[model samples]
Target: MRILWTTLLMACAAACTQPANKSVPETIEPDEAHIALAETLTPADPTLAPIYDRSCRACHALDGLGAPLTGHAAAWAPRLEERGMEGLLGSIHAGRGAMPSMGYCADCTDDNFRALIEFMSTEGQS
Candidate 1:
């Protein structure tokens, strides 16, 4: 039975080792409205402010200086124009050249991440 299991596992591994598919087309780009929505989605985390204050305010700064608060519309505008929302989030998730992963907010969820970016991007809008 063990021999049969091992052989079956090896065969499965071999089959799974196939080369990556190269024929899939690129994803369709998001339209202006979709992009706007991605950049403006409001989340429902009431703890976001306290979370930011406790975990994020140090480096990012409340006034958009140190790390540039997420709410600052101008600072993020050029980045959004150049990289798009996903690009910016990837930087936060994987850490940019300077910014650390998850921007150091360990408790943040995907929603928190989106909310942070959206809220910060609108910093100067008001």
Candidate 2:
């Protein structure tokens, strides 16, 4: 009876410790074309430019930085599908992967974050 109880406990512990399903999609590789194009992706709204330049431009413009490059639709599509705008906002607020919390924008409002997302997600459309 004691051995049976120990075995049951071990089984339960193993089940509880199993890793959750990893559903991440394959990231699209950034080509030279995409990287150069990312450089040209800037927020059309003048008000959002400073915020983007200050917070998002550095990492998002470069490839292999673990950031979805600004204006790379292929890179951003799966993320958008999985996370939606709200989830993206939450990730930004909490910082996920290589991104820092609030994307390092100390003074940005929610509206500003939305606008930046829109600009980056759309401007790269081919």
Candidate 3:
């Protein structure tokens, strides 16, 4: 009886010490490698270039910041879904989380902001 109890305790300990299974998601989002690659890309649009360099590039194009890395469609898609274009604009206007109002584009107009968003959100695709 004591041996049976001891064996059960050992089994429980082993199970508890096992590493967790990180099951894959049904929809595979972009992996870290993609995200890392995206971090180095900027908008291709010439008009939006300065705007991005001045404001969006610091956070969106870089890692270690809460802002979503640019060019990663998987990351940006959900955000777009949750907060439509209007919501994104409002967030940009009022700032969201680590982002500041107007995303630090002190001179950018709403139209410019929209273009910048479009450019950043659609960086990698053809």
Report the C-alpha lDDT of model 3 over 7-125, residue by residue, as the tens digit.
55345434544333233121224456656776667666787787788888888766666666677655554455556677788999999888989899988888888877776666374
After superposition, candidate 2 runs with Cα above 4 Å error: 1-26, 123-126
Model 2 Cα shift for residue 33 (angstroms): 1.1
Clash count in backbone of candidate 2: 0
List TM-score per model, in order.
0.54, 0.77, 0.68
Candidates' C-alpha lDDT: 0.54, 0.74, 0.65
TM-score of 1: 0.54
Clashing pairs in 2: none
Where model 1 places Cα greater than 4 Å from the true spot, the runs are: 1-45, 62-66, 124-126
Error of 3 at 23 (Å): 17
lDDT of 2: 0.74
Alpha carbon deviation, residue 30, candidate 2 (Å):
1.6
Note the clash tally of each candidate.
3, 0, 0
